[model samples]
Target: MTGLHERHLAVSPDWLALYYRHPLELTHGEGRHVWDADGNRYLDFFGGILTTMTAHALPEVTKAVSEQAGRIIHSSTLYLNRPMVELAERVAALSGIPDARVFFTTSGTEANDTALLLATAHRGSNQILAMRNSYHGRSFSAVSITGNRSWSTTSLSPLQTLYVHGGVRTRGPYAELSDERFIKACVADLEDLLGHTRGVAALIAEPVQGVGGFTAPPDGLYAAFREVLDRHGILWISDEVQTGWGRTGDHFWGWQAHASSGPPDILTFAKGIGNGMSIGGVVARADVMNCLDANSISTFGGSPVTMAAGLANLSYLLEHDLQGNARRVGGLLIERLRAVGAGSPAVREVRGRGLMIGIELVRPGTDEADPDRAAAVLEAARAGGLLIGKGGGHNTSVLRIAPPLSLTVAEAEEGAEILGQALHTAT
Candidate 1:
C-alpha cells in the first residue's frame, strides 16, 4: 500500500505546512484527546488551529449534521433556507452591532474577502491599513493584506495596503513602554499615517493576530484607533477568525476588549462556528452590509447541512455556557503553562488569554528567537504524547496552544506535565 506521506507529497502543494518531523495521522478524537492512525492517544493542544471550537466529534454537532442531511442537505441562497436564517439571526445578535446583517461563506478566507469588498466599496477606496504582524487569511486579497512575509506569497494585489504599528506588543520599537504609553504611541502613529495617506478605506486587524503568534496590542488600543478612524470617516474591520465565539474567554468577541464607541463596521469569523463543518461568515451594520448594489448569491455558503451544524454547535456552546468554561479552564491552563516555563531559558514569553496561548522561544539568556529549539520542543512533546503547534513572525519560534473550549482541568494538568518534560529535554 502507498504510504500516506508519499501520497500527500505527490498531491499536496509544497507550501502546505505539516507539524512534527514525523507527522501523525489523527484518526479520531473525543473531548481534548485524539488518537493517531496507530492508535496512540495524545492530548490535542492546538485543536486544528482552533477550528474545533467545542470538542472533537461533539455529539450535538454530529446529530445536527446527520438530521439535516436526512431531511435535505442544501438549497441555494436564492431560496429561503430556515437553518441559514436561524444561524444568521443568532450570529447577528451576538455580533454586538446594531441592526447587523450576516452573510455566510464557505471559509474564513471568503468571509474576509467579502469584508474587504464591503469596506472598499462602502468607503469608495481601494486602500487598506493593516498591522505589521497581522494575518487575515490565505486568499489573494487576504494574503495581500497579511503583514507576515512568510504567509504573503506575492507582491501583486488588487488593493494598496499600508502597514501599521503595534500589532505585536513585545519586541517592537515601543516594546519597553508602559501599557498606557504603548496605546497612546500606537494611536499617534495611526493618526500620523492617516495624515500622509489618501483614500484609506479602513483599518483591518486581527484582535489576537492568530498566525502572527497570538500577539495582541494593549486592551484598548483599537478603541483609541476607533476614535481616530471616526474622525477620518474610516471603517474598522475586525478579523475574528481565531478570536470569535468566546474563544478569548473574557469577552464574546475579541473586539469587546477594545470597544469604545461601538462594534466594528465589519466582523469576519470562521474556524469554529460549525464545530468542524466548513462555515465562515461576516456580520456588519445594516448600512455597510447593504452597500453592495449588485445581486449576490452563495451556492454553498450556508447550505442547510453546515448551517444546521452551526446552529446546533452554537446552541450547545451557549447552553453549556462554554464561554464561562473557557474563562475558568483557560485561566488555570495559562498559569500552569507559565509555571512550566518559569525556569526554561529558551522560553522567552508565555502570552495569550482564554484558550489561545503562545510560548515564544528564544536563545538561552538572549532575545534572539530560536526556531530550531521550538521545533525540537514540538516534536519532543509529540514523543511525550502531547501534540502542539508552532508559529511566529520571528522565524516561527512561537509555540501555540488553543485547545477546545471544553478543556478540562485534568487534561490541562496532563498536557502541562508532558510539555514541561518536553521543554526541559528540548532546551
Candidate 2:
C-alpha cells in the first residue's frame, strides 16, 4: 500500500471499504473524468456512487459555493437562512406530494431516519415493510429496514421491519411469473404479510434498489402494494436516494413508474442534487410532516453554503434539461451494454434504467454468483482507465454503471468498449 493508504488503514474503521488494490486518491475531477493522486486520468463511471449528479466541479455550483462561503459558511437552524428557505421552497414544490414540507439533513441515512420518525409517529406504529434486496442507508433504523443481508449489520433497531419479495425479477420465487402475474403475486404476499403483523406504519422501498444491485420490481408492482396499504391506512415511503431527479430517465421520481397509486406519502432524497455538496432531505405532506409534536432541528442541515450549492445545481439541471439527456444517452448506453453482455456466459443478467445500469456476474452456466470475477472486472476496468462500482443483493457480483448526467455519446461508447474488454479479460 502507498503511504496514504497505509495511514488510512491505520486510522479508519475496519469496516470502511475502499475500491481497487491500490486505493487511489482522487485529486481532481471535471465533467466525466478524474485524475488520481498519481495523476492518472480515468473515466468515472460510478460518479462517487451517483453523488456527483451533474458533473464534477460544475462551474455554476462551484461559484455559488465559493460566493456563499465568502458571505457565511453556516448559520444554525435557529435563523431564517435565505438560501435554505429557497432550496426548501423549490424542493417542496417539486416533491410531487400535496402541500409538501421539506426537512433537510446532511446525508441519506439521516433523511431516512427522519422519515421513519415521521412515519412511526403519524401512524402510531413501529412496524415497517421493506422489500427484499432493498438498501436504504447506514444508520440503526435505516440498516434495520434494509433487506439486503450483505449490507445490514444488525437486527437491533427501534422499528420492527418485515422483509417482502419481488424486488429482483430474475432470482426470486416469482421470477417465472408474467409481469401481470408477478404484480398480483407480490400484492398478495404484501397482503399476507400485513395481515400477520399488528399494523405497519409505512412501507419503505427503493424503486431501483441501489446497493442491492439496481434490482427492481416491474412497474406498477408498488402501485398494487399501494392499493393494499391504503386499505390499512399504512403510509408508503419511496427511498429515492438513487432514483430521484430523473436519474431513472423514464420518470422524475422513481415512484412515478407506479404513478397509478399517486405520489408516496413520504420521499427521502440524498445523493446528487447538490452535485458534490452533502445534501439530503425528506418531503412529506403537511399532515405527516406535522405529526411530530416535539421540536426537532438538524444542526448542520440546510446551511447557507450547501443550500447555495443546491440552488445552483438544481437550476443548472432544470435549465439544461439533464433529465432528457439521461433518457436519450442512457437508452443508448443500456443497449450497448446488453449487446456486449450477450456473448458472455458469465453475465446472468443486464438490467437497470437510465444511467444506472447493472451487469450481474455468475459462474458460467451456473446459478452461483461470481464475486471473484466481479472483483477481477473491477480491477481490470481500473487498469484500462475506467472506473466502475460493484454491488449485489445475492452477492457482490453486479457491476454498477452510473456516470454523470452530462456524459457525452463518445464517452459512453468508450466506457462500453473498456467494460466489454474488461469483462472478457476477467473470465
Candidate 3:
C-alpha cells in the first residue's frame, strides 16, 4: 500500500490537461523500452508519438550533446555554428536536394510556420491548400492550414479559404474510389479553386498523412497535385514532420516515397530528425529561400547543442541503415497485423505504410463510432506493458504504432502479440 502513488498527493488540478496520459510516470528509457517510476517496463511502440526515432540514450547522441554543452550551447542567429552548417549540408545531401537551403526551428510547428510564411512571401499570395484530415502544427499559420476541426478553436482567426482534397470513400480504407478517380477529384477541386481564388500561395500535403490515420494518398495523387500547382503558379510544400527521417522506409526523405510527383518546392521536416532533440528545419530551393527578407531570423533554432545532437542522430541513422530496418521490420509487422486482423470481428481495418501503422476498431453490429472500445484497447495495452496512441478524424478508433527504426523484428512481433492480446481483452 506504500508506494510513489501514496507519497504523491492528488489535487483537483494544476497542470494543463491537454491529453489523456497514462497513469505511469516514465523515469527512464533504453532503446525501445521505457520504465515507469514504479520500475515496470513497457515496450514503447508509440515512441513518444513518433518522436524518439533513434531510440533513447543513444551513445553517440549523448556524447555529442554532452560535448556541445561543455563547449558552446546558445549563440545568436547573427553568428553561425560549425555543427549547424554541417548538419544542414548533411540533411541536404541525404535528402537528395542538391544545394538545398535550410532554415532551422525548434519544433515542427515553427518549421511549418516558417515554410508557410516563406511560401506567401515568395509567391506574394495568401491562400494555401491542404488535404482534409491533414495536421500541420499548432502555430497560427500552421493551424490555419490544418484541416482538422478538433485542433482548432472557435476564436481562432478565420482560415484563408483554399481547396481541400483526397480521402474519398467507396467500401473500406483501401477499397476507396480508384486512384485515378481520386486524382481527378483533387485536380478538379484545385483547378476550380485556383480559377476563382485571388492568390493561392502553396499546395501543402503529407507524403503519408501522419496524425490523419497514417493514410497515404492514392497513386498519382501527388503528381496530379503537382501538375495543378504548376498550372496555377503555386508552390508545393511537403510537410514531412512525422513521415520524414526514414519512418516511411525505402527513402531518407518522405517525399521520395512519391518520386513520380517530382520534388516539392518547399519541404519541412522535424520529429525524427534529431531523435527528440527539439530540432526541425525547412529545406527549400535556393530561389524560394532567397525571397525571404534579411529581417527573418530565429534565436535558438540552430543552437550548437541541438545541431550536435542532430548530426549524431543523422550519423547513427546512416551507419546502422535504419531506413532499411524500418522497411524490413515494417513490412513484417504489417503482414503480421493483417494476418491477425483478417478474421477479427472487432477490427474494421489495418492500413498504413512502413512503421506508421494504424489499427481501426469497428463497432460490433454497426459502422458507427466506437471510441469506447478503442479506449478500452488502449487501457488494456498499457496494462499489458505496451504503449500506443490514437489518431484519425473521429478519434473513435485508431491505434497508431510508430516505434523506433532501431526496433528489431522480434521486438515488433512481441509488440504485435501484446497488441493482439489487448485487442482480444478489449473486444
Q: How badly does each model clash, as a count of residue pairs?
A: 0, 0, 0
Q: Which tens-of-lDDT digit does each residue in 290-400 have in candidate 1?
A: 999998999999999999999999999999988898899889999999999997988889999999999999999899989999999999999999988888999889999
lDDT of 3 by residue, 1-427 (tens): 3354434435434432322334567888999999987799999998887999989888899899999999988995789689989998887766666568998999999998888888988988777888777888877777788776656433354347464767423233334557776667667876887778877888888877777667776656777778877877889898989988888777767777568867788999988878879999999989898897778668989989999999998889989999899989999998888887775788877877778898877787676547788888888988888999887766547788899999999999998898888888988
- What is the clash count of model 2? 0
Worst 10 residues of 2 by lDDT: 191-200
For candidate 2, what is the lDDT? Answer: 0.93
Model 2 CA lDDT for position 300: 96
Per-residue error (Å), model 2, residue 111? 0.3
Q: lDDT value for candidate 3? A: 0.80
RMSD of each: 1.1, 0.7, 2.8
Q: For candidate 2, write residues 59-106 as lDDT tens digits.
A: 999999999999999887998899999999999888889999999999
* lDDT top scorer: 2
Candidate 1: lDDT over CA atoms?
Answer: 0.92
> Which TM-score value belongs to model 2?
0.99
Higher-TM-score candidate among 2 and 3?
2
Cand. 1 TM to true fold:
0.98
